[model samples]
Target: MPETAVADTATGVPLKELAARHGLASSGRLLGPVEYARQLWGYRHFITAHAKAKTVSTLGTTNLGTLWQVLTPAINALVYYIIFGVIIGTGANTTNFVPYLCIGVFVFGFTQATVSQGVNSITGNLGLIRALHFPRASLPLSAALVEIRNFITAMGVLLIIVLITGEPVNLQWLLILPAMVLQAMFNMGMAMGGARLGSKMRDIKQLIPFIMRFWMYASAVLYPVTRFTDHLHGWKLHLVEANPMLVFVELYRHSLMENVTLAGSPRLLWTEAVIWAVVVCGAGFLYFWRGEKGYGRG
Candidate 1:
């Protein structure tokens, strides 16, 4: 019998002959495990490269650039301690308000960094985005990575404070790792969303600082949420209970404080956190992806 050949529909070439001539018999459309793995590896490499280049470029601008990440948060913590702890007399009620405020500010710093820096991630990288055709998500991811690096540095400062204050470190402290991961996931989503929104509406850039300030006051960073639950009733109480930052702060206090749990309502707060994480992340990713091509233009 003679050998049979299949014709290529688009080019009108014999498929088998083309395959034999070009040594491409096994190089069909990428629909299987090998192709998937190859693409995944390529994406991973691209993301890592983008993150590294961004980190270096961002930190190289100043002589004490990297140190400033740690130093800035430490200074902010001191300011908060002086105003809220020493001057305002809030610390007078708590046994160790220093560590309490330290953790609160440090965690909140992650959120603050995300909102403030994220607004400019797309605009700031307009040159690079227009010049390169890589994934737009990489920009926000790179920014988030830089923020996480700063968070870790601030965390080191927090640990030093914890030790100096004679606080005990235990296995529960490990819980913070997952909490931080969750927090980062939440921030990444928000950053991506913020980047997309800010790119479209420049007014959003101006509003972020005010929003963050209001968020700080509402999140129980300065005072415990419990202080409000005692005075409010019904819907107002529900509003306070539904704040995602309240849950996050409670989680931090629970992990750091000796015996603190979700003070008012554990179930309600956890549900809010889980819902916010899912909804914000999902919506943010979709919003960012939809506008991926537009980011490079303006």
Candidate 2:
């Protein structure tokens, strides 16, 4: 009888109760975690197809095409070799310094590309986000996939370069598979977090490059991780060794290069890498999901 008591006129039922009974929800309602993950799984095929399409189209406009993927990192390694390896003499005592540096650059580039693209995944696809009704996580995921594809191409070239630099194709090289899988997991987490931040704060997209550059330097992409251990000791040494990107780079180097010393013990490096991947991937997914309802809104 109250003025606020709205009902389904014909059925004489409260409107809210009727909607619930019919399994209806607000347009922007947040899904429960289980249901959300289920929906995401349903779109797995779509995600892969979308990723493949983007991978091909991303470099389609360029004359060099996908060659740019390998060339970009290859060229970066060359420059770093000139500055650090030659000019600074960081490579003075290191064996296969060219291959070591290339491994670092190419491996770090995978994370850099994924996170950088993830930062724009949502903001860059505003129109698509507004027009479509799909799991928003797909954007960052697809972006990560694009980089994964590029990284694979770049990796082939990397192995060739390593061999050209006189590193043997030994049993340890097989370890790159697990190392890359861990790195990919970590990169995906970073991408999702970047997507959420970029969606909410557009300015983050501009700052990500500088952040990634700093990360690259800290990851020891140009120099050996020993550079950190040589200067810092105790907790400082431990802290630098804990860097996930550095962990991944060292993992690849250990697998590919002979007689390379890691910043930390092998067990410690692997343990930290596994921890980083699990924690970041879980946390990033939850963080992005929590903001789902707010996406595409002012």
Candidate 3:
């Protein structure tokens, strides 16, 4: 019964090997991708439940409650409309600018919230991290889920705005289903990635708001994509063209508004959407898993 002895009486399997099989032992090393996924799946209920509870508590203090979810983005759209659409005239040249602006705002709102919340996911839930034995990723995954819930609710308002602006409901509107699925996958990845980084560097959380603001502007939330292309050239323009957020925004605008035209071909944008979704989500899941043991301690 030496501490280092490998022998176990009952199974005659080496104690170390038995521990490894059960995942009770390791090289004090990163978990493999498959193993990490298994762990996450085991806690799926915790993730969903936590996300739902957080959503409720988030609105608990407000008199209007969940109504704020839709209102906040609507109010944001109005402010941007006044400044970018009316004052600076960024939306003037665009056809059906209100619908165009609404789609952009609503869609970008999800991405912006996903990343910002992800950055705080781990740090914001330090008490849970310190106290719980479950996967740390549940924190960020739940954060993304909360935003997803908000996005779904806000989308109803977006559809209304598009209809009020005279967008015909067509087969194209169905495209929102796939577009949202892809974007959600991407946000999950981005959120998990941000969660891992934020846990280690708390200062990064403070900078996320400014970063998301710049990202919203760059994603053409309140302005036309033409604003970026008008003065830019070479790969610089292509960089803007291929931005993941821009791809998502264009997808939303195209699906919801007949008057709007996408900057890239639909096929190409769909391909890019699939690529970014898989790449970000797969990579983010793996990255978060790799740091499995370090979260609570660090």
TM-score for each candidate, following the candidate numbering: 0.82, 0.92, 0.93
Tens-digit lDDT track for model 1 on 1-298?
9977779999989987888888564532323434443543567767677767776787889899788878887888899889988788665656677777787788888888877878788888888887875666777766777788788887887778877886788887776776777778788889889989888888888898889889888877776555676688889877876776766777676666674535455455556667777787667777787675577673
- Assess candidate 1 and give its lDDT: 0.75
The 10-residue segment of model 3 with minimum total lDDT is 23-32
Give the distance in Å from residue 261's predicted Cα in candidate 3 to where it truly belongs: 2.6
* Candidate 3 Cα lDDT to native: 0.88
Give the root-mean-square deviation of each candidate in angstroms: 6.0, 2.3, 2.5
Instruction: Show the colliding residue pairs in model 3.
Output: none
For each candidate in the order shown, give its overall lDDT on alpha carbons: 0.75, 0.88, 0.88
Alpha carbon lDDT of residue 78, candidate 2? 88
| Best-fitting candidate, scored by TM-score | 3
Model 2 CA lDDT for position 168: 88
lDDT of 2 by residue, 169-194 (tens): 98998989999889888988999999
Runs with alpha carbons beyond 4 Å of true place in candidate 3:
1-5, 9-13, 17-29
